[model samples]
Target: MAGFGWATHSAHKHSANRHHLRTKARMDAGFRQMNGNLERKGSLTSSYLEEPLNKTGVVSCIFSLKQEVGALVKALRLFEEKGINLTHIESRPSRNNKEEYEFFISVDQLSSKALDEVVDGLRTQISGQVHELSRNKQKDTVPWFPNDIQDLDRFANQILSYGSELDADHPGFTDPVYRARRKEFADIAYNYRHAQVIPRVEYTAEEKYCGYREDNIPQLEDISHYLQTCTGFRLRPVAGLLSSRDFLAGLAFRVFHSTQYIRHSSKPMYTPEPDICHELLGHVPLFADPSFAQFSQEIGLASLGAPDEFIEKLATVYWFTVEFGLCKEGNEVKAYGAGLLSSFGELQYCLTDKPKLLPFEPEKTCQQKYPITEFQPVYYVAESFEDAKEKVRKFASIIPRPFSVRYNAYTQRIEVLDNTQQLKNLADSISGEISILCTALRKME
Candidate 1:
């Protein structure tokens, strides 16, 4: 695409918000419904094309075409002949001409010279005036982890803006405020539809998870029981405080911390750490799926008796896969990672033009550094849960460990392979307790 010259904008002065309102109102008039907001293009604002593209090496350009039939085919044929790869395609009413429409196209791996050539080719071959209107360059950025207390306020505000609020049906606690907070968390958790990890289950009394606590929020039992029926994992409740290291060790399944430690009482949506919201909403649902449960366990199992370096790698894998991973759901991409699943702002941000999406590769994901203070600049996309599980297993197999582990459902404890006499005795002591066994083994280490 040519420089910024081709971009079109409203001649009248309009603020960014005004432009957005006008554009959104107009765009919605035609399409059935939009999953995401319309990305502004043209001279009125910063052109997306000007932004730096990331490793995905994808660039998008908008061109005008007549509403006449075969016009789109001719335009596509031009790219096919030039061997240009088109990643996405959509159309909008031309700002200059109402009768005609502008086709927005995204292409991969095409440099400035090559893109210019394609634009020139389209202009010469097509009957309509094909102009490269706007382009967006996807830039690579460091992963941002929110570590500040204030960030919670910003996150909560954004989540509320998405119309996610507490409901009466949400989980309740003895503390009225805590009960309301749990309700808000329930609303937040069920805000997004997650079909990939949460499958329907026919629960039996034997299949029900027996870990619900009185302080634990409601709806958790339903979700946890559903998960237990499917993934062989339950949503276990943890009382009071526990360090990050101890939290995962004491439970083979995911654990939800009580609401007493919840951050931001005024805005319960803001969780400084993985409180009830993060655990029950973010982690529990995923654990309900067998494949994801296995993947999670592999990471958990690999952490045992592993070097710090290996542990870090495993954590990175968990971060990408379990916390903020995305997957292809039919034609559109969907969020499955708990981090994205819980926060509306982050979830919507992932689906927006921002953030670099990389194909999930264990080595690359493990090596990639992440930030803890802000919205992630990048996320890994898996083809499916099965694909994610396979890649995770492959990565887990290479982690340096003295012993392998297998989870026995009948005993409900992890069987350590080739354990010493002392280890064997400890395992026998906690015969049916996975978390206690892991905790004992951790203390021994």
Candidate 2:
């Protein structure tokens, strides 16, 4: 809603309706082309104009076209003529020109002369402008942002599986038996689907490294259900480490991406990275507390579309608070951070005078640097979870983003509040809920 400008109701309604019409027309044409191809080929596989070439790499091209019937199909026909194999295709309404749509296609890489010919043909023939997106530009582009919960499947292979490529200094780097067991856990996580019952793991004696008794090791499904009931937080299995942006985005949807593997037995009480021990003993319990869950989600919401520098700052804030934070328990400081709770050595060491303890301040805490593989030299202590949440909420207000987003529970989708219609729809839903509450109160009286 940040960039929206005030406009007359009639003008706003007209614009919204026009936009809807254009979207519907584009979809209709796409469906018609698909159906025609299906009818001709009699199957989806045979519908391709050319078989994929034995190319070593892929190339992405983007083009824009004025709104016209059969325009998209005509462009596809050009690719067929050039014997170019399209691997993927997507289209979106152009932001710069409302009268046109931008099309993105990934095709098998071609020689410079052939690629230039294809581009020239499109420019002179169907599409007015066509350009190949450079690979470096693709990497620098905005990271893929998920709009739906199921889109998380895209990150399944985002990291190495089972720590198979662990550093030489890692405790499990040379332990084949430990690495084999990790692969088993990784397999389970890889096949997991959204909304499916979470698979349970029976931890071996050596795997219970988080100081929890064997009987106290709750099943992942049970913890997921408890968190869902108490604070709308649930868990999904992750392969391994995620980029800070991807991990924080899961919080926006009240989802936590947890690892299934246990740490190496050699270092039962310590781990270089998060494993099931850290997830269960340190993170799961705090998520059941509503105040802490809200605080966690606030950090996540602030990361969405934030600039790279701000993302680094937010990751630092998370490192200090969620990973290694402390809280005042009346007169004593208690460990609340997952890193402190999961590591026996750090848990006791943090409470001692050896480490510097400072009051939690988002402004300063985000700037403090700490060690990753060793005990934290500094810890930020908050008075209460609620206090931390409020401080973080204020801190998030200054993050630079063009629009605000809200998670719509009913649809399970993130609604970008960038238009008048979206605001009106949210207001109507709230009013209806308030009316229901008032009626119930009156009846009780």
Candidate 3:
């Protein structure tokens, strides 16, 4: 709620390696037990939060969403039939509670049998839902049309198109007034390697978002400066991630590449598009964390290689976890999911009872669709950080993992999509360099 004053795991300078020293000592004793690590607020509690515990075999799935009762019930049955255990759930109102939305959900503590069946079954069920679904990640292993490489290139071209369209007036962005603001825009994207956009509005100057955002600051005219001033982010690799964009045209400077965004005190749910206030405070800390930093860099790099569908799916994954995911330790749930951590409302709701919790399975998560407007009806939880990291790591691979597919298409289309141009170009590019790379990479076998 305030500026640069909150404590963070990034500031966790106690030498986590000592954790291993203690772990080895425990191992020499006899049995190795690890209580999941948890550090929650007022009401949250976990055995691990109080002490260290070990797990012989535990699987955690990560997820989030927004929808109604019937939709959730259908999702529930799919997990139920597979013997999957539902562990945690929380919900928030839609953007405006826009659509009679349900709660956000989470599930954890699953068995191998539950893993195999639930994954297989939910993969089938999630796609079947009338909504779009996204799991943390699971590749087809068979080599789909695209990989992370493709997503990188696809967005490159898009940014290029957007960038080229920018008038001399707007160097980094293409909007009218900023048309004259282009040079100022490109400098930040290039210097800080923080080239992202957010729509800038004159009247909402003090509001959280004006569309394109970066570093979570409202009117983030310069991303590089924001990184330096806020969290001391130098963007060595983050800078590299920017140049990888091969798209010829310049991307609109309006794209709000952020570390912070504003939060509405009166609101009750988290919005995926961050305001300057939220981004700077919530995201920058994680970026400063070594594991999280490297992981995000790899993800961005991997995105350069992924396909369109994969990229879109990845966005959902990011939304659910890095942006708005939650985790459970012992019986208490804490906010590890960025969306929850950054959001005041979801910060509370994700740990509360408005939504249903489900065991996280890549297959099922990929098949489930969620609304961005309000609180989620379901959340996928992991017993530990490994549950969260391993899945994301797998997504960067070249092999195909399972993907979500639907048997029926929803007739109610609130959104209009013109797949003609973007898809065609994207499809072509995927089949072009990405397809060849996947094929060659797989040939190593």
TM-score of each: 0.44, 0.66, 0.37
What would the per-residue lDDT of candidate 1 be over residues 345-381, giving only the tens digit for each residue? 7777888879999999988998887655567789999
Model number with the top lDDT: 2
> The CA-based lDDT of model 3 is what?
0.37
Residue-level lDDT of model 2, residues 1-445, one tens digit each, is: 0000001111111112111111223312312232222123222211011111223366555677778998888877877777878887877775335567777777655532355566676778874445223232232122234566665554444542223456665678898877777877777777888889988888777666544564646677888898899999998887665556666767878888887776677665545556666687778888898888889888887876565567667777887788778998899889888766666666778899998999999989878865433456888999999899899888888876545667776666666554455677789989999999999999999
Q: Which ranges in model 2 have alpha carbons more than 4 Å from their true place?
A: 1-142, 160-162, 202-211, 215-217, 329-332, 433-445
Report the lDDT tens digits of candidate 3 across residue range 1-445. 1101111222121112112111223211211111132212211110001111323233333222335456667666767777666555554443212333333333444343455555555446553211111122223111111121212222221121112133232222334443333333333333442233433424334232332343333344444345545433332111111121221001111121332223232231322122344455566566555455444444443333244455444445554555555666789876665555655665666677888877655445655676434556788775555566677666546413222211111211111111233345445655888878989999998
Q: What do the candidate models score in CA lDDT, each in turn? A: 0.49, 0.63, 0.37
Q: lDDT ranking from best to worst? A: 2, 1, 3
Off by over 4 Å in 3: 1-256, 259-273, 395-398, 401-445
Whichever of 1 and 3 has more TM-score, that candidate is: 1
Q: Pairing residues by index, what is the TM-score of model 2?
A: 0.66
Error of 3 at 345 (Å): 1.5
lDDT of 2: 0.63
C-alpha positional error of residue 30 in candidate 3 after TM-score superposition, expressed in Å:
56
